[model samples]
Target chain A: MAYTVEGKGPSHIGIRMSNDAPPSHKEEARAQAEEALFGFWVFLMSDLIIFSMLFATYATMTHALAGGPGPKQLFDIHSAALETIALLLSSFTCGLATLYMRYDGSVKKTLLWFVVTLLLGAVFLSLELHDFIAMAAKGGVPSRSGWLSASWALIGTHGLHVTTGCIWLLIMFAQVAKFGLDPLVQTRFMRLALFWHFLDVVWIGIFSIVYLLGVIS
Target chain B: MSADPRRERRQELHGYIAGLCLALILSAIPFAAVMTGALPRAGIVWTIAIAALCQVMVHFRLFLHIDLSRSHRDDLQLILFSLLIVVLMVGGTLWVLGNQRAMMG
Candidate 1:
C-alpha cells in the first residue's frame, strides 16, 4: 500500500502551512472591527440626536413644579447608586468580554463574559423600572406635573433604550451560539459592544445632570 | 510583577478599571451625603458633574484609546466633533428652555 500521512502530500501544500500563518487572528479581528466601528459611530450620531431632543424636553420643564415630586424628592441617591454600579460594572464586564475576544480568542470565555454583561444590564434596567413603578404608585404619573412629564419622557426614553438593548442582546447571543464567532457575528458583537458602552456613558451624564444636579437646588 | 511590553492593551484595560473605580468612588461620596441629608442637593450635582468629567476622560483615553497616536489622531477628531455637537444640543436646550421657564414665571 502507498504511504500517505493523511495531512502531507503535494496536493496539501495550500492546506497546511504554519510558518507565517497569514494575518494573525488579532489582526483579522481588528481589521473586521474597523468597519463595525465606523458603522457604530454613525449609529451613535443618530442616537445623539434622539438624546438631544429628550434633553431639550427635560430642560424645558425642569423648573415647572405642578403638584408633584421635584427632581430632588424623586431621585434617591441610594437607588441611583445601585443603578450606576450596575451599568458601570456591566460596562467593565463588556470591556472584559471584548478583551477576551481580542486576547484570549476563546469564544467560550467571550460568551461567558457577554452573558455576565447581559445580567448586569438586566439588573440596571430592573432597578430603573422599579423606580418608575414606585413613582407611579406614589401618584407621580406623567399627568401629575410638568416635572413628572419631563421625567417620564427622559427616563422613559432611556428605559426604552435598555429594553431594546436587552432584546437585541438575546438575539446576538443566539446568533453567536449558532455561528461560533463567524466574522459577521463578531462584527455584530463589536457594534453592539460599542453601543452598549456608549449607553453607559450617556447614563453617567444623565445621573450627573439630572439626578445629582436635581438634588442640589 | 511587571507587565510585558507586548501587554500594552492589558495595561490599558487595568488603567481604565482603576479610573472607573476612582470615578465611582468620587460619585459615591456625595451620594452618601445626599441620601443621609448631610449635604445639600447642589453638593450632589457638583460632585457628580466633576466626577463625570473624570469618567469621560477615563472612557476616552483608557478604553477607547483615543490618544494622540498618528493613526488615532483622526479618531480623536471625530470623537471631539461628536462631543461638541452633543454638548451643544444638550447645553443649548438647557439654557434656552430654563430661561424660557424663568421668563414665563
Candidate 2:
C-alpha cells in the first residue's frame, strides 16, 4: 500500500519540497492580511448597497419640488465642482499614502501623504457644508420638499461617510505615530484607504447624477 | 519585498500619477460640457454618465487596487455581486415608483 504525504508528491515542487514543512511565517502573515482586507471589502460592499438605495430614493424625488427650490436654484455647480476636485485630490493622496506604506516603507513619506489627504478631505467637507448652508438660505431645507429631503438624505449620508473616513484617518495617523508601521497598523491603513476610495466612488455618483444632471436638466 | 522595491515603488507611483491625470481629465470633460452648455441636455447627460463611469473604474483600478488580475479576483467578484444587488434593488424601486406615478395620472 502506498500513501501520499501532502507535500511529498511530484506535484509538490519548489517551495513545498519538504513534506513536514509548515507554511512560512511570512506566508501565514500574507494569508492573514488577505483575509482581513477581503473582509473589509465585504463590509464596503454592504455600504455600497446602502448608498445605492439612497440614490434610488433621490431619483424618485428629483421632481417632487412641492413648491420649493429645485436643484437648479439650490445647487451652485461651481461650488460642487470645487468639492468634487477636493475629494478627488484627497483620494489620489490616499492612494499615495498606501503606496508609500507598501513600497517605500517610510513612515515620514506615508504620514506626509496622509496629512495631505486629510487636509483635502477637510476642504471637501467645508465646501459641502457651505453648499448646504447656501441651499438652506434659498429655502432648500429637507422639510421644504421631497426633492430637498431626498437630496439632503443622499448627500448627507455621503458626507457622513467622509466624516467617518476623516476621523479614521486621524486615528490611523496616531496609530502610525505610536506603533510605527507594524503589520496591524498597515492592515488598518489598508482598510482606511479602501474606505476613502469607496467614498470617492460614491461622490462620483453624487456629482454626476445629483449635481451635473440636476443643473443641466 | 521584491528583488527591487525601488522599481516597484516607481511603478506604483506611475500608476497613481496616471490614474490622477486620467481622473482629472474625465472630471473636467463633463463639468466643462455642462458649464459651457456646448452640448444638448441629453448629450451632456451621456457625457457625464460616461465620464463618471470611467473615473469610477480608475478609482477601482489604481486607487483601491482592484483589477481583473487573479490576485484581485475575489475582491472583483464581491464588487460585481454587490453591483448586481444594487441594480436589482434600485432598479426595482424606480420601476415600481415610476409605474405607480404613470398609473395615477
Candidate 3:
C-alpha cells in the first residue's frame, strides 16, 4: 500500500496503516495524535497573530503615557524576572512530561511532571496578578493612559491564556484519572503540552519587548 | 523510533536540560544588561530583542520539537508563514504610526 505524503491515512482520525503488529498499535495512537497536533498548531498560529497585533499596539502606544507613570516608575524587573523563570521552568517540566509519556509510557511520571508544571504556572500567574494589583493601586490602571491601557491589554491577554491553561491542566488530571493514557487522552495531553510551551514563547516576547525595553527606554 | 531505546531516552533528556540552561542564560543576560546599564539604551534594546528571538527558536526546536529537519518541515513551514504575516502586520503598523508621530511633531 502507498502512503500519503503527509503520512496520514483515510480515517478521519488519520490512523496510520502498517504491516507490523505491535508497532502498528503505536502507529495507530500516533496517527490520532498527529491529527490533533496539526489542528492545534493551526489554532496556535492564529493565537500568535492575535498576540502579535497586541504587541504592535503596545509598541505604538508606549510613548502615550499622558503624563502618567511610565515603565521605569511602574515595572519591577525583579518580579518580572521571577515570573519569567517560573514560566520557563514550567515549559521544561511540561516537555519532560511528554518525553516520559513517549518513552516510559508511565502515566504516573507524566502526571507528576505535569503537576509540577501546573504549580509553576500558578506561581507565575500569582506574580503577574500581584503586579497588576500593585500597579492599579498606584493609579496605573488601564484607564490611566493609552500606554497603560495597551500594556494591560497585552499582558492581561497573556495572563488569561495562562489561566485557561491551568484550568486545562486540571481537566487533564481528571481525564487521566478517569480514562488513563488511552489514545484520546494522550492526544489531549500532547495538545496541552504544545499550548504550555507556546505560552512560554509569548512570555519571552513580552518580557523582552514590553518589560526590558520599557525599562531601558 | 530508535534501535536503542535507552540511548534515545538519554539524548532526549540531554536536549531538555540543554534547552533549559540556554533559555535561562539567554533570559538573564538581557535583564542583567538592562539593570546594570552595561550598555547604551539602544544597545540594551537590541540585546533583549536578539536574545528573545534566539530563545524563541530554542523553545521551538527543543521543547516543541519543531525544526527545519525533514520530519518537521510541514509544521516549520506553517510557523514561518505565520511569522511572515506577523512581521508584516507589526512592522508595518509601527513604521506607519511612527512616521505619523514624526509628521505630527
Give all TM-scores, in the order shown: 0.83, 0.91, 0.92
In CAPRI terms, model 1 is classed as acceptable
- A78-138 per-residue lDDT for model 2 (tens digits): 9989998999999889988888777656789889999999999999999999999999999
Task: At residue B38, give the lDDT of candidate 2.
Answer: 90
**Best candidate, DockQ:** 3
**Candidates sorted on lDDT, descending:** 3, 2, 1
Give the Å shift of residue B83 in candidate 3.
0.8
Best by TM-score: 3
Model 3 chain B lowest lDDT segment of ten: B1-10
- Which residue pairs in candidate 3 collide? none
For residues A58-149, what per-residue lDDT tens digits would candidate 3 score against the true structure? 98998999999999989999999999999999999998998887667788899999999999999999999999998898889999999999
lDDT, candidate 3, B33-98, per-residue tens: 998997988888888989998999899888888967665677888898999999999999999999
lDDT value for candidate 1?
A: 0.70
- Tell me which of candidates 1 and 3 scores higher on DockQ: 3
Model 2: DockQ score: 0.81
